[model samples]
Target: MEWLVLLLIGLVGGTIGSLVGLGGGIIVVPALLFFSTYTVILNDISPQVAVGTSLLVIVFTGLSSTLMYMKHKKVDYKSGFLFFIGSGPGGVVGAYVNSYLKVDSFSVYFGIFVILTSIILMFREKLKRKEKVNHFPFQRVYTDGEGTTYTYGFRPITAVIISFIVGFSSGLFGIGGGSLMVPAMILLFGFPAHVAVATSMFMIFLSSILSSVTHMTMGNIDWELALFLVPGAWVGGQMGAWLNTRLKSKTVIHLFRMVLIIVGFRLIYEGLAQ
Candidate 1:
């Protein structure tokens, strides 16, 4: 029964998360933290362990989603690589820092982060404006496997700074960092929605690998439950990626925003109650 619940958590979390490049960590972490049976079943359950397990699960979820995106050729390797360079080290730092914080403190901060992210996502469309980028360092033109072309420019230095911050937050909070990356890519760096989603997945793949490894060393992961969760995440990730190819960019953003809002409220409630 416990295993069954874990599987379901992974499935739902992976589907929604992969669709928006969130990597399902938001879903998994909260579920583990609040589920009625979570602490009951796992005697050693802590917020840090919950977060660590989520990160480990994201490793497979990100891989599955990335492969699916690769098939569609939506990945922007150059930007993805730049994001990874900064995020990798940041993830290590965040994971280590987690050892110093209490669960309640982390919960409050996580709630705040979720709420802020939701607000930004909600207002992003209304804030969209035409801006000219004349001197960004990284410029790219690429065609996806579906023959859709995207042209965009971004500053490498800016991307690295943001990616590092995103990585740090992801490692500290046990998220995939996609919640931050997707919005930054679109709103801050002027990336197309689909490209942002795809590239975010690639970045998540890189940073989560490092974060999960750090968590492993800290004894903060639950391997027994991860065994149940990973399968569901893998299957759901592929499904979500496939659905992404068929949806319009606006629809994807709307869905992503809705998820964030709902999750954010729940997180806030949990933090206050604690």
Candidate 2:
């Protein structure tokens, strides 16, 4: 039953993460911490272990989703690599920082982060992008499945700096960092929605690799639990990428925002009570 629950958690996390480029870690990490702390099913799940395991799982989730998105030609490979420049090192730094946090403090900070992410998603659509002339060094033109062309660009240094922050959050919290990156790509850098999501997943893949490696060296991963989670996450990643083409994600996004808020408050309460 515990194994089954873990699988389900992976499935749900991967699907939503892939669908929105949030990287399923947001779901997986909290679920692990909650179950381990509140129930007998999971035992002794420290924040470091939960985060490390989540990052490991996100590697597969990102890989699976990126592969699916690739078929649609939405991923911006060049930009993804550029972003990785900062994110990779930042992930290492974040992983080191994670070691210093206690359970209660981790819970409170993570809860706050989750709430902030929810707020970002909630208002992202309403936030208007300022019109500006494109003079950035890196320019990209993308054509979606519907044959609509979108042009976007960003300064290479700026993108790397942003991705570094995103990567740091991922390392610290075991999230995919797409929650932050996707929004920045769309609102700040003028990336098309699909392109932003796909590219963000690519960056997640790369950053997760570096973060997971750091976690591994710290001996924070639970290989037994990770075994159960990876398969579901893989399947869910594919499912999400497929659904992205067929479904209107507005409803899903709304539902996800509510879930984040609920989870965020619960975590905060738990930390305070502890």
Q: TM-score, each model?
A: 0.90, 0.97
Pairs of residues at least 3 apart in sequence or in different chains that clash in candidate 1: none
135-249: candidate 2 lDDT, tens digit per residue: 8778888777778877788888899899999999999999989988998998888888878888999999999999999999999999999999999999999999889877878
- What C-alpha root-mean-square deviation, in Å, does candidate 2 show against the real structure? 1.1
* Cα deviation of 169, candidate 1, in Å: 0.9
Error of 1 at 26 (Å): 0.5
lDDT of 1 by residue, 1-274 (tens): 7889899999987887788788888889878877743467545568789889999999899899999999888889888999999899989999999888776677777878877876766766564422454567777776666676666778888889999998998898888888788878877676777778888988898899999999999999989989999999999889889888997546766776676677777667766776
Off by over 4 Å in 2: 127-133
Candidate No. with top TM-score: 2
Q: Candidate 2, 210: how far from true, in Å?
A: 0.4
Q: Evaluate all candidate structures by whole-model CA lDDT and list the values in order.
A: 0.82, 0.92
Candidate 2 Cα deviation (angstroms), residue 96:
0.5
lDDT of 1 at 113: 80
